[model samples]
Target chain A: MNDQNGLTIAVVGATGAVGQQIIETLMKRDFPYKKLVLLSSARSAGKKVNVGGNELIIQEARPESFDGIDIALFSAGGSVSMELAPEAAKRGAIVIDNTSAFRMDPDVPLVVPEVNEEDVRSHKGIIANPNCSTIQMVVALEPVRKKYGLKKIIVSTYQAVSGAGNAAIEELELETRALIDGKPYEPKVLPVKTGEKHYQIAFNAIPQIDKFEDNGYTFEELKMMNETKKIMHDSNLHVAATCVRLPIETGHSESIYFEIESDDVTADSIKELLKEAPGVVLQDDPANQVYPMPADCVGKKDVFVGRIRKDLDNNKGFHMWVVSDNLQKGAAWNTVQIAESLVNLGVVKKK
Target chain B: MNDQNGLTIAVVGATGAVGQQIIETLMKRDFPYKKLVLLSSARSAGKKVNVGGNELIIQEARPESFDGIDIALFSAGGSVSMELAPEAAKRGAIVIDNTSAFRMDPDVPLVVPEVNEEDVRSHKGIIANPNCSTIQMVVALEPVRKKYGLKKIIVSTYQAVSGAGNAAIEELELETRALIDGKPYEPKVLPVKTGEKHYQIAFNAIPQIDKFEDNGYTFEELKMMNETKKIMHDSNLHVAATCVRLPIETGHSESIYFEIESDDVTADSIKELLKEAPGVVLQDDPANQVYPMPADCVGKKDVFVGRIRKDLDNNKGFHMWVVSDNLQKGAAWNTVQIAESLVNLGVVKKK
Candidate 1:
């Protein structure tokens, strides 16, 4: 670690699923952190977790927890972020939130470094990472939007159980194993954990992701539609999302149909731009049966795009399949990338 | 079975997955039939399957097998249909082919009875069944189309492995069980059974269903796109599809975005129309967390429609989730329905 460049970092929800992935991604990307502070709820306060190499003690996150923290990443649920994010920001740390609490707030800058890097510099002490599904989609379509101008985007998501948190993942596994063994099992944590109803997600697809909104869309779907527009800096962009959860443990796949403003754009030209785009991996060789899948992109840090096709009827429209590890590039990597951008752009305050 | 108003029926691919379901559907629906003749490939000949509590011996399919048959329902592979469908039809039997062979042929009318039962009478000896993914979508959307006049349709399917036949179903189960037990297994029948590559479909989603067509869309995607227009009798309708195979064994779910010509359609009006549409069951109630899911619609005879929503930007556009049993309605029941339409419409030959 370089003491001159490294800054103090605090990770809220250090014991949770996306939280652990954030810690691992920081270590993997060799993120500059002279000192790492791990924080959790009171129930897991004294728990020990291994960092890059050394064991670190988790402390309960509080108003005073961000006393000297330069960068704090929050993945602890929306309520915790609502309660503690302002406290951390007021104490001096620039918070990078992974929940939806501050995302739609006009004061907060929702950032996906590859799609909206400059937005990171405008953050007023807190930068919001876009939703998991939105992050991968924006990463895949930003290049195209920059080249031809995106007019409309309609997406249908095949999301993993892991996006609902670790408990949902365990439920998928236990339910799958039980169903295979011909044993009956009860589902307690799927579709919506807080909602009264739960559905079996193993070997099935549930159309509802989060709670349903009055408009008949799920919160997850709204997050995707809203966050994509914000991150892409296009308020007029037509975006619609149908978010569904599958039994997959990691990686989220989306089938996106987008209409570009230009009439001259072809599928190959879009593929060419994506080939060199930042944070995107082109896995689209349809002749060879090579396309992105959840299992293949589980540990990857880049969004994978494939199945690029020109719409048979609509000349200006095209379709693509985007996939990425929901926990990695979708949350952890995107959050860490934002932190790196802040450090590079001198957005983090000096000690 | 009584001879009065009964027709001798022959089922091609009698030993395969859809063929067995077709036979069962006939009995379940109480179809009029004086005799049942089972025909299969030479490799599957001599196999016996119980039909309506009677053991029917599967016989080798040949030109002579069509003798005295009034109607033949074909569910064998496409090659089998191409070879024997005409042979059966030439002997005065109306061939309801359930393969992709004659679906696009001008001489063969592609039919989804609920959508276009009148198309059944125009069949030149052979009538084609729409693809599983297309069948369910058209069945769900036909009412909307009829009321408002469809303009465009974009569908992304989370299809079941059983659509690929019994081998793919076995592969999903075997691979899932092996993976759950932490054992190794080979995937021989997924993505495409005859393709050069094989991808794991357990705990994953494969974006390619059938083999890739020359134009980047897979064969299955083409089926959904092409067959929708034909069955709906709208050549100018804009249709696009992205087909992906999931580990689900029986039911197929589609996230469909469609546009109608009418400017005055609301989501509620659409729901009301579907509530009264034949062969459709409306399962949309976001408040109570009720929606159409593959697991819930496994053996259902009707297409399940849910999550009806109006597009935020496009007034003419609406989105929905459609689910149906791929083996039941998607294939066998739809095939049997076409047969019943023939009898009801007096399209079948009378003895």
Candidate 2:
């Protein structure tokens, strides 16, 4: 690693699912990090993890943990970010947050670098990663937005259980096998497990992803709406999201409908733009039945998009299917990418 | 049984998946019949099925098979329906075709008795059952549309693979298990297998249901668009559908966004109308985390609806989810319901 450019990176909540992926992504991308720090809660602290062939011991995340860290990646939770993210930022570390804590904050820049990489420069201290469902959709839609100009968006997601957490994914597999074997299993971690009730995700579709707000939108829906506007810098863009958790174990698939600003925009033209778009892999050969799938997107970072078509009557209306590994591009890779961007933009300094 | 009202009933394609459900639905509903006839291909002709504790042998379906039949319930493929449906109708028997053969025919009435009981009388000789995806959405939305006029409908379906027939369901289960086990299995029946290539449906989403039509919409999407207009008798109403085959086995789920003519409509008002509507089961209780799931609706005859919410900033727009067993309400039960409607309305006579 070059001493002049390499920086020390700290991964908060390294033992967690998304946190583990963040470490793997950083290693797979061969990010230029001079040193790496792994931090978790007190319970998970002292555990050891194997990342990119290196065995690293986890330590408890504290306010003083960011003393010499050049970049801190946070995916513990919203509470952890609210408590420690600012602390790490105040210590002169560029914080890349994968929680909802700073996503809606006016000062934080919610970024999907391909969609809003320039916004990263304007961030005061923290950079927020959009929701997993929103991340894939924006990646697919940004290319279309850039070429055609987006006016409105309506998205219905077929999200995997992994987006909820690792336990939800395990629950899906266990419950599915139980149902196959004619055994009854109670659902304890779906449709917001912390909420009063939980719904079964075995061959079911749950419409409420997060708790409903007073304005009638679920917290997850609000994240897509608000985070999308922030990342695209288009508060006036009309966006409606119906987030549903399916029985899938990993990856998230979304049926996105959008109205472009141009009248003569065709599905073929949008397909061409996405074919050349960054972080996007077009799998839309309907003749050969090649389209995106969550099962196929597991462990992948690129957003998979297909089924691009114009509406029958409305010339400006279009529909597309967006899919990506929720744990990868949605959370981990995006955080690691932010770290990479910090070095590339010379925003991080070694202590 | 009263011989005067009793009619000779024939179930076509009696050995197939939907055919078996149609026979069971008829026997369970105690359909009026002087004699029950089961007809299939020559391969399944001698097979005997127990219907309501009675053993009925399947006979080969031929044009003359409808000679003594007073009514015919056809679950055969579209090609068989095209060949045998009119032949039975010409033999003085009312033919209820479950295939897409006569669905879009101007002379044929597509009926979901609950949605359009009056439309049943307009059937000249052949009646059509709407697509499985369309049947559930219209059944849930028609009640609200009747009270308040409907202007536009946009539906994105999280459809079950069972709608593609029993073979696709088997493929999904097999492929899913193979997927989890890190094995390779050939996909033979998904996303229109015969039309082109096949993709694994386990933990994946395929946007193409039926083959691509002349327009960009898949055949399944086009069927929903045209069938809704025919069944509701609303040629002017705007309808758009994006059908995706999920890995689920039986029940089909749809996310429908519709605009009502009245501007003062509320979500509560729509729920009230659906609660009292026929063949509708309101499972919406977001406060207590009660909503409909496809796994729970298996073998059910009624349409299950939940997650009803009004669109923000648009008083006339509302969104709801509709789910039902595709083989039941979407096909067999609806076919028998039309048979019952014919008997109740004196559209068919046994002398």
Candidate 3:
């Protein structure tokens, strides 16, 4: 598949959860590459990953590793992205950073393709991926915005532990078994692991997803509020988020209550818009008991929208349930989609 | 402890989940009664309950059983309450109905003592206990309402399976183990088990808590909407709910977004109001990571409120997280409190 547009692609932090999914999504989609480069922290540098039936050795990620790379996918921790993303961009490689380090930066274009693909063209070398929760939400809401014109959004997320990293998933499993065995196990990973106290995430709901900001919104909540505005290019749109971590392992579900600027919008109108919306699957059939659930959304790239209804007594208000695989559309698929968009738009040329 | 108002107090549905909690709550509060009557359906009727060094045999709840009973606490299913509540009321016994039988019936008062205790005095032989989800919400919001006068509410609930029934809990446990062992398990008791096709609750979230109503709100959601109005006595106030079933077994957590009529209401003022409000535990220390979780609230009776914050750019809007043991404040404890209120207010007197 190598041609004039063929280029080397590097995946930073290539062995973690989202990294693994990004590799799978790229291979399954048959992403074109002249050479595949895998980079990770020194601890996982020597690990090998099989991509499209070919084993690629992961090298330690350093600023010098971006030499001759056309596109770099960074899923490493925020600190790594903060230090290496600029370096990779300075090396003539366009960096699609998946960390929060550059997402809120005014110069960094946040791309969701379905919602803001054109934003990628304006990327100043470093493109930022929206938060997983925000990506799924913007995907589900973009069609509505196009049709009905969104004014305000209040979302409460039933998020999965996988969004907290692989350690949180392990903690959920361990705590489930510990609770089943009637053994006293202290929680060490959920509701912000580095915070003062931890709560078991196995069969409980933790209201906190990220560290609490002084305004009482968690950082995760703030990400949804800020990223939605940036990606939608509407700073005047009112957005509020309550990010909660539940026991689910992969898919993240959100209960979104929104008001449209147009009063002519109905629940069926929103459903119809979502039915044809790209990267959105409308599962709202109340008579058939069809609605999106996290378990049903595992491994899926499409954001599922269901339970669509007009708010009682408010002609302008509507509520919808949205679910998407946090690791897929939320992270990996979105990242790969951005790369694909870059190629289709002819933004990046062959090395 | 016997006095001129000494009377027999009967607890219908005394053997089930919330029924047992009601018995325990009564014992802890030292609820006064000259005689205690325990009644249940024929299946649970011959069983016995030991409460505070007293063992009472469960009797079949027939119409004649209300004889000589001055007060009746009904935590039985809706059918049983619909059948037996009127019989108890006709027999001169004040009935505290915990089911959805008469909550919306304009004639019956839906009372949450903290929110609408004044309405308790106007009960015409029957005082309807608000839905479990509604009780916690009204408790959390009543203080805010008393301080700032409420306007609108939008809530999404993460409810426990125990609210469905005892069998749903068993189904969740068995399905969880089956899923872990890579075994196929048919769900028989979740997302409306009586309807066609049961869904798994293990490591999953079900958006439908009850069957769909004509308004597109699930039965559980409607209960919150209707009961909130009745308890808060605000038929003109806007309310919307999205009820969901998570894997958790006991507590019901609500992500509530509300607007107050007054711009003077701050998140800090709401917190101070809740801290001083009766039966409310303010767990709002985000710095210490002290938000409430269902696991910590499994056996407790207090409604936990935390993550309170004012909405940015909206002076009248605020958000809060409300949680409590669904079986407690949501059902049993609220039922017992109604019974206590009947005696304390001298609404029910001995013959």
Candidate 4:
């Protein structure tokens, strides 16, 4: 309410999980915005949300919604973003999309500010955010990649249900209660809500996260593999991912095994490197039983890493566990950080 | 009993989790036995467990209690087996010990019947069962190794609470109920019941399983690493493990990435081989949404394999998911299968 002389910002998908977080994050970071426009689909247009002592009614998102907006944050479904992002950019608004719509587009720069902040300079009105699983991993590994030169990576994720959406979280909670009470519970929202088959995620682990590709990799797994290379600017890097959904609610945890190009690299050196890396917290004290866990990392912005150890056979290979909030650093905080980077780089000027 | 000419089998620690499964498996498999003896520690000595509709009293396990027994199965704690396993063996009873005390011993055989049944002939009275996680993985990989020659393996495990014991399962049930009810719950049994630290496993994933070794790998992780090497008889194979505990109650799932010695192998060939491999079921079908899940694998004795795919960058590398009932295949069924192998190999006489 006090930034009356700043740039105008609009938040699309204002009622969704990441959208709500984006609003909170904008307020938390004291984002320089003269007017914050809240927009959503027609189904949710009339909802009201309180923002810093001002009540804002959600409006149906349209091409005209970006009329005078300087920076529009789009996090609705991928189709909505695919349709609305270019229109927003056409109207002179820099759209930071939180969907997978324009991520792999040659014109769009997929940015993780800590890893590739300068890539924002090349954004064609729409800068893409990487996948939640990819964001935490690349943040933890960028320092090592910059120092030792990474050659390969194999990651298996223990992802929370919140990564699926709000309905999936509700399904986990409801199904867990039904199972605990010895009542029949039918799953209708996991492994992909619109997918044909549904699996119980309560007290169980589902190996599939999204629709499968022809090559047998899930879309989420492919995102991790592809997004890492794009953000790091290395097309030749070796990466593979197995993303599995767990009973967790918010954080995404990964077991990563990687090989560096140099043979002299040790786990200790990597630990020391991550200890000083930005947006990364090293939590690898096994003696005192200190390590990052999903429950402990909920709502945190920093990527927490622990259990760093060198492979017994390969001196160049190292293993670590990384955990972070999927909704925060993986989605909201990272998006807000990109906006801050835009403001710092003078991509968006204060009016 | 009907089998008047069959062997006399004694079950030590006959009241614990694996012991209960051992009894049920024997009944389910119709194991040939004349006199069935049940023995436990002094604390559980007067308890009664019905076996095949016959009430059997649990006697105190001692050196003399194993007299005239043809085969003895031990699933008690390590110290209990360290003290009583040798006693059972000295009384002319071939011992099948489930504790880790004698697994690495040069004179004892660590047997998974499907992987290395011939290793039973060298057993000097005690045949050891491998850890739950190790048993399922080695079973799934032995066929792969024999056909294509595995050179490297990196695994991340999604384990169940029952792998710890029956008490840990109870703790999961109680803690999950508390969390669902929005009440406070304390973790007293997970990661390691007696270990210094406890973490919430309800709606959370705990990376630490068992105590952390000096090298930063948990003891459970070390078990997966060491046991895989020993079972496969490849001391130089490169293996790394990140063992994690989830809230699942029965099945343990593993995401395994492996490099074969040959570069011409395809994902289809691996699936074809596992489809016919003993004690392994291939459940990979992405088109029909068929894959191995923890809930579906409960009460199953066979190891379920799915999601087989080739790596995008490495031609010789492959990834797959393996799941099995931890209590059955990982412990009781594997031990009973070892006994059946002994009977088939003519090592144990039924006269």
Candidate 5:
């Protein structure tokens, strides 16, 4: 089927926030797809989604959906990916999953194209996209780490509500409007959608992003800490993260404090390296009041880096601000880039 | 004035946000004032401000305004404090300044009552209130630092717009409403009121809180870093801060990562220490999903601390979430507390 025209691409959970972005990104990139298949739950199976100029119907996602697909992008949920990703892989569809289902698996490779593009080749059957917050941080840090060698990372994220899903985005909008009109609202989707308690994210900051793990760290923070090690392939690198959900709807920003292995490396050298690094745009001109901000990075795909400064007390420590569209670069763009990398590396070819 | 019926209290910048809070705090605390005088700029003079059913006229803050006052709380601006604080002090009024003018002065003490109440006695007529971000953090860290022996601190703040002033509060509300209504708005105030470019703060985070310094850190960030050392009276303590302004209107939240000299300290032990600390509230219960949040901490005077967790990689490192009302504990309450400490310590006296 792939050889008849070109590669066949299937997008699982096509009606979700990230799944929608994946479809848009696939169209925007003009991916060489012989056929594009959209899959969702049975409830949304007949939904019509227009990609560029073509209208396609979303089919119910199942094992048979990947019968003739070459590459499948999954972003619905962890459970959905867990249930159907292997089935798609078994049907010879190279699955680039955007869920946490296979990210930490020993046999799976979690890839951030800018940081670990080569790791995509080693995937057994599934290639996982790193977490939204982790993807931008690693993209900004990879260049610095390659030149100076990273020793420690302490990050605090200012993430958007969109990372929670489209429902969370609606909640933010509705709550904000209600609050503006002097109406009371019962928050039912934030902090964690399925958690016991929900907190308001309208003009408020909730310190917990995902559910808390046994170690007292939220799952989002643990994902950043663990996935940084897995994606960077450096378990010895000390990483600590505090993930918080802000009221923003699109972009995710992070304040990262890192210690380099070399004490003599200055902030200027790190900025210079990031200036030319792939998928990174340096915006660090403090004198002119230039820096990366979430609002400005809403629609862009590049990881924006700025506010680079050496720690006043620690000669080896440096701090930076990194921002990127959580839906784009963090999820959709990275997934599409991974699929592109697979084709470019000849790891997946027309069948 | 000291030999009158009781202490004569004056609140400078009474028309301002923190100033109004100071007047309210004075009334709430029943500071035993013989007379209360509200002072503001000449433009705001003759305005009436009602505090606890007492209608006080706002007078122009001048040297003469403090002639009959025993203690004058100044929150107008740094320039106003710089000019009038010394004049008020010369007229025998103890000026408790809530600006950055005299905070770093070698002769003036920067005080957070919970952390450094005794330092109030060393003030040369003018006692400076620490920055809002610094006050809450020091309040949270003082107990742990005292018991565990502090070495290094790195903090990233989710500060409220009220810390920037009342104008910023209006801007947040305006921008939020405009965005909700799908109307266009040109941000005139945010990040900094007089910044080169204004950015939207509603549903977004601005990395640059104040103007950037020569070293690429914002002035707000520097204030937290420098004021912490001065208030703690430990110049050798390693401190780094990244101060950010969130969309919140009142409370300021901080993600603090600190390294203690004692490697044997556990997060549970730290929580126990803070549970009994002065002007501190312990809300850490991971099982119950309890933690400190900015929205929940508004109107509260205590510094709320929770999410205590020891670092996974470094035994000496610990992370916690600290939050407090920026106006109360950060400014108005702390200023009032300093005045109370002065009177209790016999540094100032009522008739």
Candidate 6:
């Protein structure tokens, strides 16, 4: 579909879980697009997908797939993004890559629109989306950091299996059913599919998300720690994370402990700031037993913040519960938001 | 079966989940008992239970039920323990109450035998068992605190449904099956049974474990914080906890970050210390992908510790993963151990 007077949009890895969500969001939001192209790997290239009544076929994503594309969303693994993102950028498309390929690159701007929409304008063709867990936390924390300067962050994540991709979700279902029926099944994925050993995640929690680095932190944890500094543009801010995969299928939940630069900040003030913060929904009322829960935030695009409280001993410390759909706010929605920001900021022009 | 030379023992709430585990542990450990009596609420009073080929009828627990009983293990709800525990203690029985009714009472000795067995000597007849989550964490941290002189502690728990008792376990199962079958089911028992709203825990994480206090911390979190200080006998130790319940059936997992009083303590040294720590299993081999996981720790007695690493920027801070079966080590085994310790220390005598 080509209007020839509106923005031409392309979605790479369109057959994957996050990719499919990106397409759905674009249609749901009625995004202004002249042409919509869906691209995937060779294995899934020929599949037909129906998006809001339009039948589209997924093409093989290659370097030349970005022709005349004004905005390209890439989620086709790190290697695919590494090969095609820069190519798409060279062909006049603003590449919003969802993989970790260029996120930590000094030249690439890692943008969480709610936290760093301004960084999107400084992008050198390719804008990187933060990790699913990192995106939600930064969105919740940015409002606070802006009001009362952040000094330190300690986060523990209860992430969903969908963050690992489609196969892991299937694995969880199969393993859970097998366990329930007293049948035998093997776990071939989880904690990292290609990693050394496979552990059961049906009714359990695995403390390792991505592979462990030499420094003993998993790559997922390092992403949150390093990306927070990059997106917030704060090198002096102390951040530590322990990322773990739970049996959940969609949303990621985090228990965050943070210290502000000033001691005068109370939990109410933080809640007040977040109540009006863009892309955040405060669900924190303990009296009615209200708090952000992963299952409740499954398809929501906004980060849900709750369980806000001041630390009992530390006057400057606070705790919060953050929950968001790993596929939406964590990946697809943020990617689309960056593109939308590009147009709103007049950085991308319809050709 | 009366041994005639051993102590007369009674198990309260013996028909419930944790109660059954207590009977199993007692039978497995070959506890020295002249006579074994099982007691429950009036509704289940006439039920017969088989423990190690011995059939015993459950009697309604009452003030006079503790007559001639030297040791009474109480795990009925907090209200029941509040009503019956002291009465049993006054009747010459050393009450090892597993409910939270008297845990924080100044007169009741809250004891985790591995961490503070000596506190058992000053029990004032009623020895309170700490919360399941608190019991596992303190067991893991006690050795580290002893060797390194801990200064601060922050923990986030991935707790099991079993901690909420049998109905909650059934709720997790029914809810999970309903969700899997594309059916609708109401959450009646999670986060808190009597609280305002119930959230699904089948494929999600609930941040609120128990009722919220005025300061916004859940009762479960407060129990962990206050109980840690009391068990460690350090009023000055800084401790904070965020307790969340997972869909797990048995084991509870915790991510702990602590700062030692000494800066010279290394991750390797901490691992070395925990390797020989009593009732603590060191499973921190990241190279071979060995760490504590909830599913693997089910039915286990020891607190499994792993993923020990030093914080990147903070020299005094360290992180570790701790897991244990909430029913076994966290409640039943710990309660039985306290009774055994009393005998070993000559505090309990066979009349």
> lDDT winner among the candidates?
4
Candidate 4: clashing pairs of residues: none
Each model's C-alpha lDDT?
0.91, 0.86, 0.89, 0.93, 0.90, 0.91
Answer with 4 or 5, whichever has the higher DockQ. 4
Kindly indicate the candidate among 2 and 6 with the higher TM-score: 6
Off by over 4 Å in 4: none
The segments of candidate 6 whose C-alpha lies over 4 angstroms from its true place after superposition are A1-3, B1-3
- The TM-score between candidate 2 and the true structure equals 0.97
Predicted candidate 1 versus true structure: per-residue lDDT over A177-215, tens digit per residue: 999889999999998999989999999999999898999
Q: List runs of model 3 lying over 4 Å from the truth.
A: A1-5, B1-5
| CAPRI accuracy category, model 5 | high
Docking class of 3: high
Residue A194's lDDT within candidate 1 is 98
DockQ of each: 0.88, 0.61, 0.80, 0.90, 0.85, 0.85
lDDT tens digits, residue span A89-153, model 5:
99988999999999999999999988889998898889999899999999999888888899999
Binned by DockQ into CAPRI classes (incorrect, acceptable, medium, high), candidate 6 is: high
Candidate 1 lDDT by residue in tens digits, B1-351: 435768999999988899988988888777788899999999999998888788989999999999889989999999999899998989888999999999999989899888889988888899998888888899888898888999999999999999999999899989999998899988998888899999899999999888888899988888888888888888999999999999898899999999999997899999999999999999999999989998998778999999999999999999999999999988999899999999899887546
lDDT tens readout by residue for model 3, A72-173: 999988999999999999999999989999999999999999988988899889999989999999999998888778899999999999998888888888
| List of clashing residue pairs for candidate 1 | none
Query: For model 4, how does the per-residue alpha-carbon lDDT over A143-193 read when each residue is reduced to its tens digit?
Result: 999999999999999999988888999999999999999999999999899
Interface RMSD of 1: 0.6
Error of 5 at B123 (Å): 1.8
Per-candidate TM-score against the hidden true structure: 0.98, 0.97, 0.98, 0.99, 0.98, 0.98
**Tens-place lDDT digits, model 6, residues B303-329:** 999999999879999999999999999
Best by DockQ: 4
